[model samples]
Target: MSTTVTQQPQHSTLGEYKRWLRVSLYTILLLTGQCTATLLGRFYFAKGGKSKWIATSVQSAGFPILIPLLFYSSKSTNHDFSKPKRSVMITFYLGFGLLMIAMDFLYSCGLSYLSLSTFALVCATQLAFNGVATYFLNSQKFTALILNSIVVLTMSVILIALNTESEDSTDLPKEKRLIGLFCALAASATFALQHSLLQFYFEKVAKTGVFSVLLRLNFYPMIIASVGAVVGLVGSGDWRSMGMEMKEFEYGNLELTITPILAVFVFHDKIYAVKIVAFFLAIWGFLSYIYQHYLDDQMANQDRSDDGLQVLKGEEQI
Candidate 1:
């Protein structure tokens, strides 16, 4: 009887279980943060918030929380730091940090005008952007399936734009909407490119995938981003109005009242035929990618198992 290696539990070891737990916990945190952050940002705008810079800075300011994780990962072994000089490392981290700040600003700009649904659907194209970046940066070959995914996802975005009638309840001017659209797409592209660059550099140059290295890559850049945001916040003088903005925030009882309000609010997203079509089309595109990922994982596992069998058979014969 052949041993089906694929049938093995992924988290068979204690270490594997811990890793899986960490991953699941982080995934949940990320999802919660993404949803609440966007909801609050848009809520600010819907309630007459005029300070985009403040909103942008808020995103960067959260980097401090990563500090503990950096310390927690300090003991992780097998990390490969880039061999470049200190200056080079500093420059690399600073550059990416600035890119992140720019992305945050762009996202704030989008939230200023676009409806949450419209902005989110447009931003969802980042996965397709990552696919393109992987092809170019990681030397990943673009098969017909990848091309189809890119196309279908692109069409989904277009349909979202066509569903313009009920995009944002705020009803900002058309020029404002156009600006928001551009900013949203640009933010998505920047996000995809930033992560792609990090992944490519670490895997190719650093040549390690340890948790410590990954943690360092995250926290270091965040420090730079936070500092940069502070400078922007001070220079733009938006901080002057920050106190007033906070005091006057329409959702003064945000923690107490906003959760249930948004749950019902977003659920009532005005749906048009175009939006329905786009929604399903996006699901189709995402599902296709998921299935392809499963196949790749299976193939990789099978190849490893075959090599293991060959080694065992050779040892037995000897």
Candidate 2:
């Protein structure tokens, strides 16, 4: 009669709880990282850090920090680094590096000219740019919802721009305001294009373990960007400006470091909706835009099929 009472482990429930906790932590970290980067960029710009190249160089420094992680990851994972040839990789990185130089330069110029709040608000239009860029670059389908999002987002930016026109409240000069507006729009466009291109490369070219891809993506670009930044700094004779920029650089650096971690580890993606209709409208617009693109693609394919059928009929008649 030596039957002992045994307790079963609640492994499934415990594992689920751990998973939920991890997701929550990751979400918070990502939000924090994004906010930190934004604030730091604004701070650097507001603090008279006008040299875009120098600021870009400082931001690019984060890539080097990943060297150890990249090495460790390569050692630990069975990743094939030889898939993308060195020359091809260099070309890709150089192209993107040049684009990034322009984008960062425009962003810096915008920040220097516009108030932080105005610049940030204008930058929000990047989503619309992204929508268009993705459609062209990746053949991303645009649905009605996506269109709605783009419209709403674009309207919001327009409203902000209109409000900024009434310069009674601020001391910014008209010329500077105009320049800032142009720079912000240009930056958004370039950023959207670059983002779309990056996504394309990540999906098609970076067909390896995440670490190997990240290393190639970040490190090589940094080299070109660093060179560009150095030349800009030297050309502008603003080598001394880097010290002030570095003072506020830590926040941006922290953001850069945390972003990749969140991207890799975070599993549960959540969108918390507010009571604002604009927010919902933007979300729906994005959905619609994507759907519309899909519809366009389907229509194009159908047209191609019809053309092929007509060609076959003509051949038969002949």
Candidate 3:
């Protein structure tokens, strides 16, 4: 008698390894996309004279797409919009959006003088600012570990900023460096305040379906920014001038790199090796945060499972 060996259907350890590998690989790609978008935004702003028009036009085109995405995500998550919390939710969204627009505009104004790398390094102080702000806001308790992390994060930012400036000629005036420092500090404050406000909204009002909350929050500021752009054009008597300028300006089709990257290569930064290292450091820091969050979630799930097992054993004993 010939016996047939039956193969059990199961995911091998290699399969699990591949699943994690894919997740990590996708995370890096997502980070790359975020970093590229951030770099390109500064590049466009730095290009000055007419690139503002390009930024404004691109933002306008992208705004409409978010609305459909918002609705779809909300539906997928089974979010109830008619829950009678509309008034509070709308207020929170508007407040958050307005705050973001104000902060962003201020940062943009400051960027006319600061280098992209300088701004990125300076922005690294956000963790410190957030910790201090959270303490004052009474939104979260700050532990010694949190305090130490903030101090270290702040020191690293200061060192990075100083190093960048020192590499510039010593003969360079003090006022410019001072202005950069001040702008960076102010930017950090704005960033921290925005975070505090957002945390409050997320915890209190818009708890379900974060994507829907993001959609509602984004919609108002987007409208405000569009209006601001139009007013800026008309106020400067450059509405006609902008149109004429757009004719000569070449906005490239959506590609791997936006128009700004090409502009940076051609007209602005050379993208040094050191800056590449800093960029990687920033990306690593962000990924570390995501990893920590995943760990916390897993712990919570394990606790819930243990609680359920204890309850089952008690019921079986009875």
Candidate 4:
């Protein structure tokens, strides 16, 4: 009877392993799709035309699509928005949004100096930044795994920086290009902080679906971004000239416009070896995260089951 019981548990464990595997695979595909879309958008932005507007335009215009997803997720999760710690949520958004603005503004200049592939690699430093920021903000002690990830990521960053060659034939100072990398690092830091803040909110305050939380989080920032975009256009004195005659700029979202521009002006071709490697690295990192999360969850479940079994056994013995 004990052997049969053990076999049943083994079968159950196998089932969970399979389920987690499937989820991990699905998550990888989702990440890849999103990455592809973002890469295409970046390409358009590099094309040096009205396509630059695509970034802000898509951000604002995509609110409608986001809304439905948010609503459905909130319903599915049974998340009570009203029960959230309002003060904490407010502070989080305020701090995160300001950092995002600063990062974006800083990169607005750096983008002029760096190549798309270079920038993409620079952005990947966020994983390391998140670890550092979490230590400072949450006072979380790092485990060996986290420390190792940071070390590996740091090495990758070094490799990428060393590998970068100036393709721009313009008379821009070499020092300015070097400075662009630091700016990109600063942007990555801000992104990491923002993510850490959101993770804190979801775990510590009120557990909610990512879709709902993201929608709510984006609401104020989107307004700020829209205002900033409008102001930038006016301040540049190119308000009248920008995106007016270009048939490509007619779309509600700028990312779509940016895609073609990037393809034509910046990257100028299909996938390259380095980019393919980067993509795989990103996917691997993402899978590692999912696996770690699943392991934690399994341990928690095992602890609960053990506790329950102990109590039942105690009653039987009594």
Candidate 5:
């Protein structure tokens, strides 16, 4: 008689759970930070603060927040992350830092003119930009759902562009509104490129471990960007006007306009039918991309489970 027995690997399940838990935590943190930062950044411009460089500086200058998290070591894993030479690391970090400065500066320009609602809607195109970057850079599969997302997002942009005159989010002129649109789109594209470069660096060059990820990908580059922002601030002499800008600005709610809905009440941003349509389209596109990502994650986990089962079966062989 022949008998076969198998034992499930409990460790694999635990590890997968931990990985997902970490991912969830990171996602929540990122979302919170983005909303908070956007609200405050837009607030700066809303109150007649004109220095784009200062706003740009504040974005990356908050690198100190990551210090404790970055330094906290965790137990080692089987994955051996690459450790590039210091000089090489410097070059890589500087490249990203410069790119980030330009990205932030453009975003600042966008916020300076566009209302919070309009700005947020434009920012939604960021994911669409990432989709394009992934298609070209990683050669990721062009699935139907993802294509739908990209097309829908493009339509959202067109919706806004078509009704340029009546979509008055702010008291700004049509020319300034157009400028905001351009700046926001440019910033989105720049951010997509930055994201692609970061992924490429981690996957191909750095192979940085999860624990040390922020140090190279964000901390170093942000420090360099902060310096660039400061230099621009001083060089442009915008720092001189900041004192009066802050003093003369009319003060209002601190956390009032955290979203587009709130912007109607807080910033008095006008709502147009076209913008309403665009917002819905943007939301649909965003949801489509998120669903596609969820599907991708499911497939990845299933493959990992299959590999783990194969290993466990081999080990249990009689």
Candidate 6:
């Protein structure tokens, strides 16, 4: 008689869970970093800080800081980071980098000319533009939920825009206000397009660890954006403006350092009901808008059918 031996597949449920936990933690940290960076950039521009190029370059600093984290994570997972790295095309990166630089410059200009509140309201339009860009770039289908979300979000932004217009009792000059409005719209569109392009690259081009992918996505663009900023800084003679920005850097930099810890706490506490509700409401509003459009289309079709029947009956009578 002969005996046979079989090997069972190894299960690593705990290992998988640990990986998930790490990814979640890192995601929270990144989000917090993004919030802080945005707030700091906005605050700096709001206070008459004229070094838009420097501000843009500072925001790109987050990318390099994450490189080591990504490398370690990849190593822990036994990923072959040494493999020939697949990346987005150079042409795409160059074009995307230019767009990012333009968007940042426009956003800085808008912040300089407009109040923070107004600029924020205008920035919300990016969500709507994102939908359109995703549809075109990523072949994202417009399901009812997505359509609803877009509609509601757009309506909310429009209401905010109207409110800002009504409350235009500010000391800002008309020319500045108009320029700010144009810059805000342009910035929103460019940002949405850039985001869409990034989504495409991540989905199609990148073949690396998550950290590596993110680092690559941000690092090269940061270099390009830094170059643009340096050119602008020299061209505008705003190199001296850095001193003023640094003097008031406490306003935003401190928040950047603190927010990551606060974000961790918020993630652990689960005290986010209000934000959840608001998010759902936006989705609900979008759904209703899409449903309404659907109904209107149906009604128009019915009216055309009725007209056709009447025309047929008149022809029979004649």
TM-score of each: 0.85, 0.66, 0.67, 0.69, 0.86, 0.62
Model 3, residue pairs in steric clash: none
Per-residue CA lDDT of candidate 2, range 113-152, in tens? 7655566556767778988899898888676666676788
Worst 10 residues of 4 by lDDT: 50-59
- Tell me how candidate 5 scores on lDDT: 0.81
Candidate 1 global Cα RMSD: 3.7
TM-score, structure 1 vs. true: 0.85
Q: Which pairs clash in the backbone of model 6? A: 148-286, 148-287
Model 1: per-residue lDDT, tens digit, 1-318?
134333343423455568668977997998788887888788778776888887887786776787787777876564455465677667778878888889999999999888777777787778788788888888876766667777888998877665556645657777788889889988988998998888876877666677776766777777777787788889988889877876787665356764645543553446678777877777777777666766765677678767866776777678
What are the lDDT figures for the candidates, one per model?
0.76, 0.67, 0.58, 0.61, 0.81, 0.63
The residue pairs in collision within model 5 are: none
lDDT of the structure predicted as candidate 6: 0.63
lDDT of 5 by residue, 1-318 (tens): 112213344665688799889999999999988877788888777766678898899899889888776656423433466677788788889999999999999999999888888888888899899998988886678888888988999899888877855746457888998899899999999999888877887777777647576464788899899999999999999999877766765553333444433542466677889889999999999999999988998899888878876766777684
* lDDT digits (tens) for residues 149-182 of candidate 6: 6676666554543443333323567677778777
Clashes, model 5:
0
**Residue 129 in model 2: lDDT:** 90
Top of the candidates by TM-score: 5
Error of 4 at 23 (Å): 4.6
Q: Which candidate achieves the best lDDT against the true structure?
A: 5
**Residue 202 lDDT in candidate 4:** 73
Q: Which parts of model 6 are misplaced by more than 4 Å?
A: 1-31, 70-88, 164-170, 207-210, 240-318
lDDT-sorted candidate list, best first: 5, 1, 2, 6, 4, 3
lDDT (tens digit, per residue) of candidate 4 on 13-126: 888789879988997997776466556544444544432333444434444556677667768864445557778777766665566566565554445456666666667777
Prediction-by-prediction clash tally? 0, 27, 0, 5, 0, 2
Query: Candidate 3: which stretches are off by over 4 Å?
Result: 1-30, 45-61, 70-84, 134-138, 160-177, 232-259, 262-295
Select the stronger candidate by TM-score from 2 and 5: 5
